[model samples]
Structures are given as C-alpha cells and as structure tokens.
Target: MDLGVKVDNLPAEAMMELAPRVEAAGLDEFWLIEDLGLAGGFTQVAAALERTRRVRVGLGIAPAAVRNVAYLAMEVATLARLHPGRFLMGVGHGMPEWLSQVGAHPASLMAALEEVTVALRRLLDGEQVAFHGSHVHLDRVRLAHPPAVPPPVSLGVRGPKGLDLARRIANGTILAEGSALDYIGDIASAAKGLDHRLTVFTWLSVDSDGDTARARLRDTIAEALVHPAMSVQLRSWYKADLTDAAIDALAVAGTPQDCAAALRRLADAGADAVILQPVRGAESAQIASLAEDIRPLLDAG
Candidate 1:
C-alpha cells in the first residue's frame, strides 16, 4: 500500500515547505485539495512538482462542472509531459452549493461528470474527440501537445451512479475524508474484476496520549456527520449517538500504535493508498508522526 499526506486547502506557500518535507520523509504521494475559494489545484500541483523530485503530486479533485473539458485536458497534459509519471489527476462533480454559488452548476451533474471524464481521458490519450453528449459538446477537439505517457485520472464521487460511472471510465476512485473500512471494502468489491485503484482519504491525528489525539478530532467528526457523503459511511454505526468506537471507525486517530492499526485495517479492507488528512492545527506534527512513528509500525507489522 502507498502512503500519502494531504495538504488540505492550506495556503499556497505551505506546499513549498510541506512538499519537500513529505519527500524527505519518504512518503509516496502528496495530495492537494481544491475547494471553490481556495488556491487553484493546477497551480499548487505545479508548485509541488517543482519543489519535489520523488513524491508523486495529486490534485484530489478539480471540479469538472466549472472547467471546459478541452482546457482541463491541456492543463493535465502539460503537467504529465513535464513531470512524466509523477502527476495524478482527479475530476468530479463539484459541490452543488458551491457550483450554484459560482453559477456553474450543470442541469445534470452525472452527465457532466461522465462527459468530462470521458473526453478528458480521450484527449490525454491523444485522440481527436468529437463528442456531443448532454452536457459536454466538442467538435474534433484535441490537445496540441499530448503527454507521451498519460496521467492517471480518478473520479471523486459518492453516489452509486457516480461510482458506477467511475468504474466504467476512470482509472481510479477517490473516496473522500471520513471514509470507513466497510465503505472502502464495498468499493473495492465493486471494482473486483477491473484494474482499479481505490484511494481513500481519512482523518488523522496523533499524540503520545491516544485519548488526547482522538479528542482533538471530536469537533471535526461532528461537523462531518452532516455531510451527505460522510453520513453514508457513518450511518451504519451511528444510532442516536456518536461514541468513541464510532470515532475510531471513521478516523485514524490516537497514539502512533493506534494510528498504525487504523491504517492497517483500511489497507486490509482494500485501500490502494490511504491519504492522511491531519486536523487543522496539528498538520506538521501529524505528518512527522505519520512518517517517523506510524509508518514504521506499519512496516514492521
């Protein structure tokens, strides 16, 4: 299993510092989040790639609804050509509210996502795309300079239909933060026959005291409970209460040993890569612990 750390929507400058740290620590991948108002995904990815030599850089998702498919393909192709096998791209349906706020929500999010992903992949593969779907319309569009080796494109989506679409068109599936073991297993099972990568993002917090570490995630867990995608994963364990066990199921928290065990469970449940997302104030320390403490335990086990 590949281990990675997410630079979650942090300031752009954070990459200059964090990317090298991740590579020095021997992490396999460095991921970035591209929320609506945050730093641009492509920009951060370029900066991270520029700063690091080994660690693979990924944009956990660029909202397909807002970007034209051809333009998105160009940006991805440029990065792939420059970095070769070191870039991973994720495209998805943007958050409904966020898309609406920006006046970019499509009439059919699923159609838009599918169309964009298909066209984007085709363009990356150096195909001349002439597509006329419900949402995406292109007439003989192709990249001027396609990558010799195309980058992997994953779909960041939650619903069943979206997952099915990912299976059909994407190289991988990106499960968001708060993904539980059962959910991961289910996704893995569904992709049984295909050569698919299941990349899971889970919350991470670590300290000498396991209780203190777990406690730090309470507020974030409470907030996650309300999101539709997160709630699906938590609902099986959630019954009128949020208990310690439930928290353990959702996050890789606690002491080094505890965090290692949590990550192991995720891997055993079929996670190709488990991306650790640190709680807000504890980013640097958690990354260090993940590298120095948790990872060694996992390696030994």
Candidate 2:
C-alpha cells in the first residue's frame, strides 16, 4: 500500500524529525500543505528534501492565486535540479479566502488553469512562450534555468470539468482523500493512456475512544468536511449532513478498525495512494499506536 502524510508544512525544526520518521515508516511520499498559515510551499519542500532521500516531497497544491505559472515553473525547475527525482508540484483552485487575499480571481478557473499549465510546459520544455490567454497574457515569458529534466506537475480537482483537465494536461492529480470512485469514472477512463497519479488524503485515527476520535477530527477538519465538493457528494451518497459541524464530525471519526475499514473503502474507490492525516491533538500514545500497532489490513481494492 502506498502511504504518505499530510504535514502542516511549517516549523522547519519539525521537518528535521518528521521527514526522517515518515521516510523510516516506508511511506512512498510526503505531501506538504502551503503553510501560508506559516511558510511558503517551496520552503517546506526544501526543508523536506534536505532530510529524506528516497521519499518524494510534493508541494501539494499550493494556492493557485498566490503564484503565477512563470514563478512556479522556475521554482519547480530549481527544486527538480536540487533534489532530482524527489519533488512534485500540485496546483489547484485554492482556498477562496486566500485567493481574495491576493486580489486576483480569474473568473474562469478552467481557463486560468489551462493557460498557466500550457505556459508552464512551454517554458519547462526549454521554449520561450509568447502566449496571450485571457487570464495570463505572457509576452516575454521564458525560463533560463529550466532543469535538464523537469518535475512532474499535478492538479487537485473534484468536478468532471476539472478532472477532464487533469486528464488532459497533468501528470497526475493530488487530492485530499475522498471516496466515491464511481463519481469520477469517466474522468479516470479518460486518463487511460497517460500516467495520472492519484494521491488521496485521509485523516485517520485508531483507538478505543471512537467518540473522542471523531470529535477531535470534527474540530480539526470541520472546514474541509463541509467543503462544497466533499459535502455535496457525501450528501448524495449517504445520509451525511452538509453543514460544517455535521460533516466535520463525519471525517474519519472512528476506531482503528473503523478507520481501517474506511481506508479500504477508499482504496476500492480507485485511490492509487492515500496520505493519512492523523487527528489533531492526538497523544504520543495514539501516534505510536497508529504507527506500530495497526497491521496492514487487506488491500481495500
């Protein structure tokens, strides 16, 4: 089973220990959230690269509004050169508030993403693109320090339109773990000939106190739980409520056995790998238990 962690991407001191430990756990990748709440995505990747060798580090969907493709392409090229096969970039329609904070909201998300993606590729392939698209008009857009071999690009999208875009353009997609593989069936089939990596994030907990675990997770991931895409889909499938508190309460709030069952469900949903997010404020005992005590169950598939 391919496993990874959803790290806070803050506190450089934390990565020194966490990075090596995650690598030691034999996880396949480390996906970093832009701790715009704390630091930039590039800084997090740099810190992680310095600590681990084999485990890949993903700048997991840095805020699209915060970065232009030109700046992002350069940083990605630099990281690939520095870390070789150890870095990937995931970009997407970011937090709504964060986009407003930057004073830019390109009306057509699909067009904005498409333009940036095309321009970034042209630059990375060692070509200067004089591309003028509605969202981004590039005249002298080019990369001088492009890597000999560029890093792979990933996108995060939930709807069919975005999924189709990922299928058409990106190497893969990075996602917060979600179930309902059937929801995006045609999108994945569209990805048949290409190598589109699916990295799903799930907040996992395993303990006897199912109520406490669920409560803690409710508080930690409340915002995400009620996100439009997540809640809308959940409500369609189950009796899951769409309100913030209710959906949050539903996020991975169960016993280790229960959480394991859920992961199995998601894997069967067509996830290639799952990045487990441990519940917030969990004790060392809990962390240790999750890491050492829980044996792998059968493949969810």
Indicate which candidate wins on TM-score.
1
For candidate 1, the lDDT comes to 0.89
Residue by residue across 32-126, what tens digits does model 2's lDDT show? 77744666788778888888999989887776655677887888888888988889788886766666676766777778887787777778888
| Candidate 1 local lDDT, 262-286, one digit each (tens) | 9889989999998888878677777
lDDT of 2: 0.67
RMSD of each: 1.2, 3.6
Off by over 4 Å in 1: 238-240
Please, what is the whole-model Cα lDDT of each candidate in the order they appear? Answer: 0.89, 0.67
Give Cα distance to truth, residue 100, candidate 1, Å.
0.3
Which TM-score value belongs to model 1?
0.97
- Clashes (candidate 1): 0
